[model samples]
Target: MSVEVTDQDAALAYYVDVLGCELRTDVEVFPGGRWVEVVPPGSTVGIALVTRESGIPVALRLGTSDADEAHARLTSAGTAPHQAVIREAYAPPMFAFDDPDGNALVYLEDAPG
Candidate 1:
């Protein structure tokens, strides 16, 4: 359950610099150049920076807890324009969160009913 940011140095810098995530490892899977995984200090797991570069970063993860509660909390907050709860029928239940740079990321909880 992680986002594949990008392999570019600048993209890596943003996550490591601004987000304060540590440089974990370099994974090479051929033809796709090099990939890196970064984790924040004191954090357990990490998200990845894949070779597929993009201006709009997106990641979707399932089987996480608290997603349904998060959706309820978000709906009550009359702040930013947000996407409604979306369930992919046969897939899991998920909702998207947009970063400051307009990158949309999805955090999922349980499978669809």
Candidate 2:
């Protein structure tokens, strides 16, 4: 999962100091970009704090066993997906869609361990 925040520092502080999530990863991946992830206690998933300019979509990402099936189900239920399931070498199969309230979300096919 990930969230788009205007300020990474403030977001990090809130998630860690206030929310009690542990800082998982804090590294500068590029000259001007930093990757910060926080995980709740006893949880395997981490929430990545990113900026809009970071090229990471600000969406709630859910894991699905089959992206195609998930997409079909959502489409059939009248939820219009933003696009078709994308299969790329750099990432898992996934698709983006908006909820009834228009909040962005994504469903990613689970990657094998």
Candidate 3:
């Protein structure tokens, strides 16, 4: 999964430092543009910081076998933790957090079918 952020460093810090994702690469497709992707440790799916500026909130619903555990990790890193995890109709076990620039983000797990 990919999402755009105002700055790559901020995004990387949050995704890496706070979210415990591993920096996948230093690959730069555009020399002057934001170009980096990070994946949650032991997970193949990744969140990318692109150069698309949009007002629409980017909701990247990421599911983990361990949401409670993930929350602990995020909070332990001193992120202003807000408990947004909820499983409801049309959505399941989703939560949100903001980046340094207040770009809305969400990672959620769906109810079992």
Candidate 4:
């Protein structure tokens, strides 16, 4: 999947450095734009960073092995502060945070196998 970002360089740093995603591809596209792809380790699904004239609200739900640990990692990385994990009877443990371009994203604990 793709997410629109105003600055590809900043987005790349955040996703790769903060989020711990690996860089899959980084290339220049026609008409003066870049095509950058990143993915979590061992995950086939990748997120493409596309340039946009205007930013838009995007929600990306990501599954984590452990929500608490993920939240802590993000917190320690200085990428998240206000987001707190929510636990409910019917809902899985989850938390939400925004990217540099204000794109909303949710991190949820993977259901026990």
Best candidate, lDDT-wise? 2
Judged by whole-model lDDT over C-alpha atoms, candidate 1 comes out at 0.61
Query: How do the residues 59-102 of candidate 2 rate in per-residue lDDT, one tens digit apiece?
Result: 89899999999999999999999999998665689999999998
Tell me the number of clashing residue pairs for each predicted model. 0, 0, 0, 0
Query: Could you tell which candidate, 2 or 3, scores higher by lDDT?
Result: 2
TM-scores, all candidates, are: 0.41, 0.71, 0.43, 0.48
- Residue 24 displacement in candidate 2 (angstroms): 5.5
Which candidate comes out best when scored by TM-score? 2
Rank ordering of all candidates by TM-score, starting from the highest:
2, 4, 3, 1
Worst 10 residues of 4 by lDDT: 50-59
Write one digit per residue (lDDT tens) for candidate 1, span 1-113.
35555345776889889999899866453444464668888996667676444322345443456676777765567424256665654335667776567655666675346
Error of 4 at 89 (Å): 0.7
Ranking by lDDT: 2, 4, 3, 1
Off by over 4 Å in 4: 1-58
**Alpha carbon lDDT of residue 99, candidate 2?**
91
Candidate 2 lDDT for residue 85:
99
What Cα-based lDDT does every candidate model obtain? 0.61, 0.89, 0.64, 0.77
Give the residue spans of candidate 1 off by over 4 A: 4-7, 53-113
